[model samples]
Target: MSKIIDLIKAKEEGSKPFISIEFFPPRTADGVKNLYARMDRMKESINPLFSDVTWGAGGSTAELTLDIAEQLSTTGHVANMHMTCTNLEKGGDPKAAVRGALETAKKNGINNIVALRGDPAAGQEEWKAADGGFTCALDLVEYMTENFGSEFGISVAGYPEGHPNAISEVEDPSSMSEAEKARSSMEGGKVYTCRDADYKKEMDYLKKKIDAGADFIITQMFFDTKVFGTFVKDCKTWGINCPVVPGLMCINAYAGFVKMTGFCKTRVPAELRAKMDSIKDDPDAVKAFGIEFGIQMCQDLTEIGVEVLHFYTLNLEKTTYGILKGLGYEVKGSAWARVGDQVKTANGVGVVKSIESDGSASIEFEGETPTATFKKEEYSKVF
Candidate 1:
């Protein structure tokens, strides 16, 4: 097991940038199972440097998140589990659940964590700190370093466009400073941006997270590369010297694009938004545009000295794969068959029962036919 920061530092400067992917836990058993298959397939294909699972609000999916993180670690991917300070007051000890989670992560070989001040729990209109709980990600970072003492590498979030909660509508766009304008977004004829003061506070808080113990930063998604570039420059101006990984959200559908950007209050460049609006009715066109746009955005990031591209996969595969393939990354389609997968053989259809080393597997046929082992070339995975 290795820390994600270590893996990153071990890479020689000016080499190909590393690929990292993020996944969120699905809400159902079947969805979870299919996600496992998809994850394994992506691991085989793109070979991400690290994979992370998002934590649900208020520990709602805490156990499931840990399980998925462990699975990722054991299956040859560096697993970065997200830990949040929300609704963790149990037995009057606010840190009890968090402490237990850290212990579990240590035992499971999850060497990195994304410390966060999480969103509100279900039915809560706003976020509030539990009694004796952390108030922000900076506090969580301090706690981890204090308790674990460098046992785990920590990364905190950076809001290139300011966090959604801090972003507000600009009553007079002309009054805004150039920096504020760069971080601003517009919707329905209203301009929105993090006012200069609030953006300074955001940057100060992010710097505190780094000083407290965070090794790196992963930013919230934004469509405009110039916004991200300016944010990076601002980070240096604020004396934040940590690595800031760009979080790229792969566009897969028109509705999802609108919903996510609206929710995050992300600044969508006018041209990109107009193109998306024009092609909103065509799903294939939307995905194709998504891939094409993602390619250009990634190239822009690379030119600006970003060493890693962290993709928010949204628990889907197509757009992410398409973008990578467009960027000249080797994407090996699923070549390994898993147990219980349907396969086609000369004899007929069968279910894979076991896979052996040296490129062979055993198949169990239907209707009283005998089970048989066949060379890898004799059968092909059908699903």
Candidate 2:
């Protein structure tokens, strides 16, 4: 089994920043078929250093996730399966599911896993510990170390701006940084946030995870490089020195963007948010912006000498491929079709759609006639 942590540590001379991709198991049989096709296509062109499969909340997708991870590993890709603390029994004739899953992964030649305190199950507002199950991610890390003993390379999640769940609801916002203020959302007009003290405690907890023998950390996605830069600096100051891989969220569809940003309480810069809002009606424009923004964001991170560029691909190809190509990564051309490739855009939030000879696209955000034709660089595929 090829361990991801060992792969990252064993980089040879002149190696470019390591590239890793993430995918989630599909729910339907047809969706799984399509995913396999896409995965094969991605590997052929991008040749990622490794790939990850995500587990559903509360082990809902455990079987499918393990199946994909095993397939990826058996087919010669370093597959890191994600495991959560859900449904795990600590003692008293505990459920064998957790141990069984680990043994199953090992038996399938997959020796890497991302340990997590996964999100609560669907329809649950807050998470409660299961009877006889581990309480948090820390416990899970300890369990793996005790049970496996150097048999797996474990990766843990690090939130650069503290986990959203840990943010303080009653903190004084007056002394908060502008960036900190941006990381909040309004429910009934309360400015809940990740206060400084709370963030420090978070760092302390992160140290415990690393100190518990986690091999590396893959951070939660962030839009601001300063947040990540500060995180890396703080990680060093705290003496928790291990490779921290930035998890990059790929810009996919318009609806998905709003949903994720809102859910994560992610800090989107005013300018970037406004740009996204302006193009909310045009998916192609949003995708084009994603590639452009991803390229610049990646360049900024690379300048900080990050050892790896891990992408949260969200199971799409065009934007990820476009971003990599924009960054001068070797990528073959793909005939991947955009969602609006053949559709009558006459139905959605926009109007007149025209594709030019040079594959440039123009759209009228309101009227029946086009008003502005954006440059090719401003967007990805022509609508």
Candidate 3:
């Protein structure tokens, strides 16, 4: 498998923009079938160098993530499975959960990982480290490095607009009388107030992870491209020269966009929000606006010379295809096409085809029935 770190370094050394796509673990048999179908349709337009499959909250989707990663590897594209320390123990103990995930990835030849401290489970009290589990993402990276050595290329998360948990504190206490001060002094006069930690804390944590063997960085999605630009500049100031790829999400539906942002704690710029609100009730208009907005944002970022753009695909191929086509991409047919039936296109092409249960397709091309199996990398070359 091609190491993600090597790929990022290659991009830094004059390679064209490296593009990738991300997907969440499928929840059911039908979901998995649907995802494979979409991957087939998108194999052409988004020839992702590597794809990432997220580990569900509370370690629910760990197995599914590995399964999907294995499938992607079979397609000859690297797959990165996300590993988190959200429920891991605080002290230095081998987290069975993480260990099992790493073992699965190794067995499946899925050598890429994105280490993180995943969000708490729905309605959970707070983020509590599991007994005998690691406490943070850095600890997970350290463990992976020590266990896997150079076998795995690791990626970590970066937040551009700042993490939601981050907050600034102000100290403003009125003067107290001598008697009251004397009493307070007896009870430990130091006042502790909650305040926002400096941005440097997050950066320092990221750097520590890198020092511990993180290969690349994928940032949280942001609507404002300027926020991403400033984030890149700050990374330079902090001496983090590793590839810091920006994550993009195309919000085609108003409700879906709102739900995703709410869950991710990401902001939608006021102007973009206004634009969506203007056509909130009109599905067609909202989709058109979303595609146009995403295309323009991508064009702007491309002009500025970003090393890579990663899309968070929520398993909706039509919308993803529309956004990519808007940004000038050529998509291949679904996973149904046979090997010999694959065709190349110069400009943007989007195809939606049917797939049978046996993972094969028979179609009439110029009065001949040709069969083809789905291949994902063929689409990347056209792009």
On lDDT, the stronger of 1 and 3 is 1
Error in Å for residue 48 of model 2: 0.8
Give the clash count for each candidate.
Answer: 0, 1, 20
| Residue runs of model 3 more than 4 Å from their true location after superposition | 12-16, 86-94, 167-196, 334-383
Candidate 1 local lDDT, 1-383, one digit each (tens): 78888888887888778999999999999999988878887898789999989999876888899999998988888899999987554456778778988999999999799999988888887888888778888888998999999899999999999999999999999999988888889988899999989998998888889999899999999999999999899899989987889999999999999999998999998899999999999998998899999999999999998878999999988778778878888776434667887777887989889988655889999776769888876776552
Instruction: List the candidate 2 regions with Cα displacement exceeding 4 Å.
Output: 12-15, 88-95, 169-172, 177-190, 333-383
What Cα-based lDDT does every candidate model obtain? Answer: 0.88, 0.79, 0.68
Please provide, for model 2 over 89-126, each residue's C-alpha lDDT reduced to its tens digit, 9 standing for 90 to 100. Answer: 33443336789989989999999989998989889988
Worst 10 residues of 3 by lDDT: 179-188
Q: Who wins the TM-score comparison?
A: 1
